[model samples]
Target: MKAKILIVLGLLLLNFGLQAKEKECIKLHVGHNEVPENLIEKKKSITHTHHLSGHEPVHIENHFGDVKVRVWEKPEVKVNIEITANAPSEKKVQAFLEIVKIHSEKVNGEIHFKTDLQCLASAFENNINGGDDKEERNFLRVDYEVWMPEGHDLTVENSHGDVYIPRFLSVLNLHQNYGNLFADHLKNERSVIDLNFGKGFIKSMKGGQLNARQTALLIDKAENVVMTNTSGNVKVLMADHVDMKTSYGSGHIDKVSESCRFQVKYAKEFILGEIMADVDKLEIESSHTNLELPLCVKGRYDLSTNTRNTDLVLKDQPKVHYITTGNDAEKRMLIGTTTETNATKVRVTSSYGRVEVK
Candidate 1:
């Protein structure tokens, strides 16, 4: 019986060892490759050649190797090519370069080619099943740099690297898998960013203007702005705008303007210290609990609580609208107005705390 048990244990260990070997991978090559200059500069010797390219723009979609490109002012738009090798042969590097050259020569609209990292997700019967020498199943890194004729627009798809754009570029639509994205000025109306979970902590350190989505929207020095996070807080500076419908976290207190619609919805996260409802219209909603509004409201005040508590501090305003406060139970507050005998809008309820609106 002991011999039989030992044999079974040895077979199990062998099977597990084979599975472990299947998970390991060889060297993973990533980053950009630079193009040679001789093939581009020496041949196009017509007149002044700088960065002014009246020539057509270059476009590419790389799948294997790094891509480094530089657009120059030249006749008969020439393209330089380079690639990196990762296996037993240096021939792959040369072969890829030659293919890029040929493709550039034939294609229209300047040149369109790519030499970046690609995945074998479609080739395998099961993407999760891979040998030890295989790359990671979830991520594939393709690094490249393409130089356009200054005013050209760039569109990248599912990339994982830094995107660099000059100040006066037309529009930059960037999407990343796992990296930081940087662009100079977003002066154009089309300069919009759609980001997915890859750490889009952005700043316009060197640019004329910046524009992000409404979720990350905040006025620099002009109009009021509002931003809401699906799973985080919205931070705005002083002389900024109103915020609404955000989950988990707080907003900055110093900034409040009339141009923005600012309010916070009920959340599991905490909102500490004065939630300044300084806007014209202040609206708040909390369920299953009570909320405290520390500032006075001037515009049409609409407050609703379904089985919750609401507390407000009314300001001394001449023209105030109907204050609608709802509750399935009792709520608490310290309310004092200009004239306690005659106030504009006041409603109260209770499940636990005292109600005061005067």
Candidate 2:
């Protein structure tokens, strides 16, 4: 009877040990792997590097600096950070560096890199963007250059700085304000890019789902894109399965391979190029703008406009029907569609503007 009780107690202890091992959080400090080295003397620049094991989600946060990421063929992750500042005095610069601390914690295969920036959040209040709200002055900036293995998820949040990633093949989530973003090539399955009052440019990206919101956006190629912008222009060279909304801006879409849905308000111009899908779906809404949608192939279309200067000029001249509603001055809504079975469904609406579809 005593042996049986001892066996049961041993099993219970083993179970608790396993649970504690699974939930262990390892906290690392700087200078463990390499010493903090100063790169530049006059500008007060310093660099640090940390090497990590295993693959997992990584999060990085910076208040004022650039962040660059790249993928390598190794199985480990390496982080390189550089901090630069231009202060009024050397003592102030040293004080700023002392206040900025790098904290890294790894738990359950996830790594988080953070810095203490609460000290400077109340110091630098300056009018930067010609707006009523005062922005924070960047007395010091910490730029990061990280290299990780492929297929690891990453999230970065940076403000008043730039973020650039080249050749990434993982899930990426980025948030940047008052800075620029440039992703050279992205092979991720999913990504979310959010920018406020900044410019964004992407090139040669392949993904199943992508969501981006920027003040100005430019993309070379994309698939399954959802984007929103305000007060800035957008341009895309080639895309598939896109849904976009814009306000007080213009859009120039070059080639669409599948489907597109666009909504614009107070736009200057909206141009849509060729549609090359077998069964495409195009939907557009415009107000106080001019739109041009030139169809390069034959498809079924449903178009409507409340302005008198709208025109539908089809070169092939398929079967069509039309209906007009309301008075000539206040409203002159025209709805038209082509009668065809197994055809692409296209719907468009415009108010106080001209839309030409061909």
Candidate 3:
């Protein structure tokens, strides 16, 4: 009986051993010829030069990279692209390089450059299923440095990177996301900037319109500016003839030379450091806002408000004459004139907020 029991036990142990050996063999077979878990980095750089008439428009579109543009005297466009890829193996790096490329062509007398990542859906799927979840997937990025002739119109669309233009003297249009814009000495007549979730700094802007959401913008000097902001902030050191609208945002203008118009709504705040005496008009309309502006002793302003818990404070000046009308429960209006003729019209209308003119 003891000899029979020992034989049965030996058979069970051998079966268990065989099962474990089979599992080990299967694991090794599955992992055979697979790429190692080590990371590999590769970089590629390419440059292109395109002849232009110096009057054609240039458009650039990119994703996940920085773009730097500068003006040059040559009547041509020069583009330099640097591509970086990180993968677990040389095969993956080559795959990324084959899919990620920059395509440039001429369309209707315009030069167009675009970053092409072919079939993003398939690429993502392949990367996800390539290896363990804890391993790093293939990553790629491209950075652009472009030089174009002066006087040519420029448009840039980018995401997840910064756009820098040191000096652009022609029509410029920029649309960016999750990045910052740094432009200095921009002299476009009809420039447009649409930014989201970023910050913009402009040293000087001649004429432009800005649409910002969840962003902050600072302009050292601006003229003929039009801006609309949501949940953001804008500050201008010197402005000439600005039309601005804000929602859940704040703005500060250090000085206004010609005219200014601001429409604020939904918990916005604005502050005007100074209004020139020769400013033709200043108009402000607010709902649930807090606004403050310095009163020009030699300028005329018209103020009106209809509100609940709104206070209008005005500073007294000998040269200015103030006329008040209406009741607090209904509508309140105040008009101030520094001179009987050519009075700088200042109008303020608010509801559920405060206005201070000092």
Tens-place lDDT digits, model 1, residues 236-342:
44333333445443443333343334334443432322323444333333332233433334323333332334443345335333333454343322233333332
Query: What range of 10 consecutive residues in model 3 has the weakest lDDT sum?
Result: 1-10
Off by over 4 Å in 3: 1-38, 119-138, 297-309, 315-321, 324-343
lDDT of 2 by residue, 285-347 (tens): 788878887654554454444444454344434444554545453222222334444455666
What local distance difference test score does each model get?
0.34, 0.62, 0.72
TM-score of each: 0.46, 0.70, 0.78
- Which candidate leads the pack in lDDT? 3
How does model 1 score by TM-score? 0.46
Deviation (Å) of 244 in candidate 2 = 1.6
On lDDT, the stronger of 2 and 3 is 3
Across 1-358, the per-residue lDDT of candidate 3 in tens digits comes to: 0000000111222232233333221100010122236657778888888899848999999877789997778889999998776566675555555656688999999899998865343333322232233244445667899998788899999887789998888889999987889988888668998999889998988888888999898989888878898999989998888788888988888988888888988746789898877887778888898988776555455544455677877665553454456564443333355334665666677778897777
Instruction: Estimate the Cα RMSD of every predicted model relative to the unseen true structure.
Output: 12.8, 15.3, 13.2
Name the candidate, 2 or 3, with the larger TM-score value: 3
Question: What value does the lDDT take at residue 147 in candidate 2?
Answer: 79
Name the runs in model 1 displaced over 4 angstroms.
1-141, 149-152, 166-169, 204-228, 232-258, 262-358
